[model samples]
Target: MASGLAFPSIFLLESHLTEDELESLKRQIRSLTTDPGKTDVFLGKLSNRERAQFELRRLGVVTVEKRQSRTRASARADTDSAPNLEESPAKRRKTGARAPSPIVISGSSEDDEPVQIVPPPKETDTIKVVKLAWFTESVARGEVLPLSDYTVYEGRRLLAEPAIMPSPAHVSRAEGILKRAQADAAGSQQPQGGKPHFMQARRKKFDGMPPPRPSLTRMTTSEKERVENLPPIPEFLHTTYSCQRPTPVHGPNDKFVEALKTIRLARQLMGDKIGIRAYSTTIATIAAYPYELSTPSEVSRLPGCGPKTAELFREFQNNGGHVREADDDEADAKLSVLRLFYNIWGVAETTARSFYNRGWRDLDDVIDYGWKELTRVQQIGVKYYDELQELLTRAQVEAIADRVLEHANSIHDGFQMVIAGGYRRGKALSGDVDIIISHSDESVTHLLIRRLVLSLEKAGLVTHTLTLSTANSERGQEAVSWKGNAPNHGLDSTASGGVGFDTLDKALVVWQEPMEPADQEGDKAGETQPNTNPHRRVDIIVTPWKTVGCAVLGWSGGTTFQRDLRRYCKNERALRFDSSGARSRVDGSPVDLEGYYGNDPATDMLTAERRVFEALELEFRPPNERCTG
Candidate 1:
């Protein structure tokens, strides 16, 4: 019989887990759940307490340190608190008794000693972060183990973060900016056609009055009248999951969605993960909304759209369909510089912030100041920043896909490919191309990415190899099954192990078109010149035939669509869905929903993807219809 965990629920922090390793852990812990709110313990391959705390913080689980253990508390406080105190003379007089003096053993006066204060006791429940080995060892012994030896941290999870006290400089800067904006507003409102004296008096009047701001407050109408005036919320909107409904490429509220996206981008640059998620949820909900928002009440009617969201919508309507924060965010100098650094291929938001803190303002600054400090991939990113930022046309993307397919087929026959990412989601242009390749023969797919990338490099199509991972192939192209019976995934903290959910044999490369012969109009007419094609980012993924359906479905949708799909799978089907494949959460078995629809391997990718939707009991949404922006 399987033993229950010592903790009520466990949250697996996704730091260093391959497909198989994740399944193995889930199988061992029967109480594993995705929501961090309900989790009592966090288990991961954590190094120290700081990392454990950071993982919790990243998931929006704010926490505070609870009271120390009795042993530690006693050591920190005075050994004899009762003997350290002396009664007041006034109290002794009132009681008609002599006061006892505090004992001073070191031949010093009692008044010479400093006072020691004790803090109040904490009453919140303790949250534990234990090492992964503890659980495995416990399972091996067929019993739950004590967490003392393997515990990394013990704290109390905060319901919400405490209010932060801003620094003096921050407050001063905010005041200065507000004052400047008010001055500008006053200047713009001054009369231009009046005489000098009249204009002077009008300016004086404006200076004494506050700038006219738009009203963002909700309407004071009764609930009955409000409901009668507002449109009924759609049935699909009732569900917060985007995967349950179709989100088209473009919606009636694109303008509002774009405005919200700008704010979200600003939040990303500022390293506000929680803010980014909040804005992303708002944008996805609005993108999936079918009606054009006419009133704040209508916006409020949408699910996940509360009074605050409605106020923002009201502000947008009052300001001629523009969010004030979005405009301000674009004009902010600090954000603009951070945005520039963040656009580099190898730099994440945190790295971008680091660059800003290091006083590097632009690509030239990065090259001149931090060239030696950069990673190989970061150096390449700086070298071709502009070329990589250029968007690729549909024709260019198709041509690149064809070239990749050609190289792939030459290495092995009977391989099939699907163009995923924004292109598959019906975008006219994409920043990069994502190609998911597979074959019916599992042997043929083994370590195929390395050979394909080599061929492309030899053909002069691949300029730079950013990262190459063979995790899937190294595991023998088999779907991860949890029964405590699968082989070790054997992943480490290396680039080759692959990061995140896309744990397939893959290569991230900088691709450029091969040089074509160009006729010169000058003295050297007979000589051929190099083609001036721009470099593009490309990701080549190799999946086994059985799970190709999951791979395609995982990579084909928008970011929100993919996130919500995984959430839906976890919440509804008790399955974990990723680009690699799906696994049952209850027993860690491979959820076989792919490659069962057809005999031909060439057309199996798409049909298999549809089969995943059917098997999961979800409405089959086409790739183009998954634009959950």
Candidate 2:
């Protein structure tokens, strides 16, 4: 019976409703089920009202009431009394009755319900009859509104107020005003009396007739003012010390920094120490800057940026962030010398230039003509020149660290190894791998580096030992006395301070990966086998458990960061900083920091480092944030 209720129309109406509208309809329907009179006050459009009637009928809560108009009654009398042909299957179900068999209207039995009569078409009935049904249902539901108030567009059933069109007179006046505005704009662009303005006249006279081409350099007054009045450089950009600023692991001013670095390198090559220092300071400052700079003026106000530096920046800006190589013959020659000297492991700018003055041009030249003059370390450096120059990838570093750990554990259990240096600081490539080994028991690390290297060498991992020093060796005593005797010597002293806290037991070695079966086969077949996998430089430093934190912190660095850390310790805390441990300057007593590091073996190194900072009243910095440019 519910099928005759035109329930399909409700689905069609739902298809057009938005989610929010559907939810609202659902709420209204639920309310109507409780209180049928609620549907009577729903003031929605005819479509909504009819939709509600269809839903109510489907729920078996409402039945349609037929009306006997004159046209409908006449049509009904003419039709044979079967269910009306115009009645849909859905309408038949609404009455809770089966369709009747053919019978005369006057012969219909009282047991059969009367079906709705179909209305005949009228000449004045321009509106669709289905729409009239919706209107009638809306009225029954008490959605009372004037017929003239309803407006629809296209085929959509919308409820909107009728639009009012503007009068023709008002439109004409608007058009007149638009034409006047266009005329005024055209007049303003032309000179008075079609004669040139004073500035134009002067430009024409002095320039001997202006060029026919349009000028691209011209700017309006506002644009000119904006160019002259840029925002001031931020206070943070005024920093002169790298340690005071927080430089991210990566930055936006890479192009600028690269250019400055190249110039600094060139200066170093040219043996201009002062120039190198100046450029380093400026490069560090720029690298630490947070924003990308577009104009030279943006950096003109920064410290360490002199007139020459400013001009270089402007030139770089003009060249689209690229720096061209110097074309001067003298500069190029000096650069060549600088490159040659800088590549030698033990050679500094001073030594490189001295060799250059002695007529050495290339590594071959140095070997052939001055090999005898080279130090033993420099000789080894030349022998493995190509191998030492190659950078170590993070993966290779980790593999080496694993091998080191394997060797350390063989000698004693519970030994901890940390891969420090640039690798620890998150650099993708490093010059060498630095490994620090320690154990909770101090006795385990007494001769750790020496025993570890012997084991690694026996296993064919360590190819050559470049240096080996034990903690109790006489060399350590000599190193200590060297520093103690020279109180006024700068931190750059290579004999003592430059050896990097010589008290710690350490070794430097050349390492190579073990040859696999495939590599051995290739070597036997003489198939131009790989060049022994290029010997890599590795440093192994063994420290007692108590000082492992200081060792890790000291060795993990960007060079400038280490320098500043030592400077801070010396100036601010009156302490001497070193990889082994920190000691008081007054009486050379160890500054106990054991309390900060709890007894946990896994986290003791980190905890101890943090405690060192706390003990010294300094803020702790993470490895990445300690870039210091």
- For all predicted structures, in order, the TM-scores are 0.66, 0.57
* Cα lDDT listed for each candidate: 0.74, 0.59
What are the per-residue Cα lDDT tens digits for candidate 2 across 155-222? 11111111223234434445644564576668855423422211111221111223344323333575
lDDT of 2: 0.59
Error of 2 at 621 (Å): 2.1
Cα miss at 205, model 2 (Å)? 43
Candidate 1 residues 293-334, lDDT tens each? 777777877877777788888779889988899999999999
Clashing pairs in 1: 482-588
Candidate 2 lDDT trough over 10 residues, lowest sum:
120-129
Q: Given candidate 1, what's the lDDT at residue 491?
A: 16
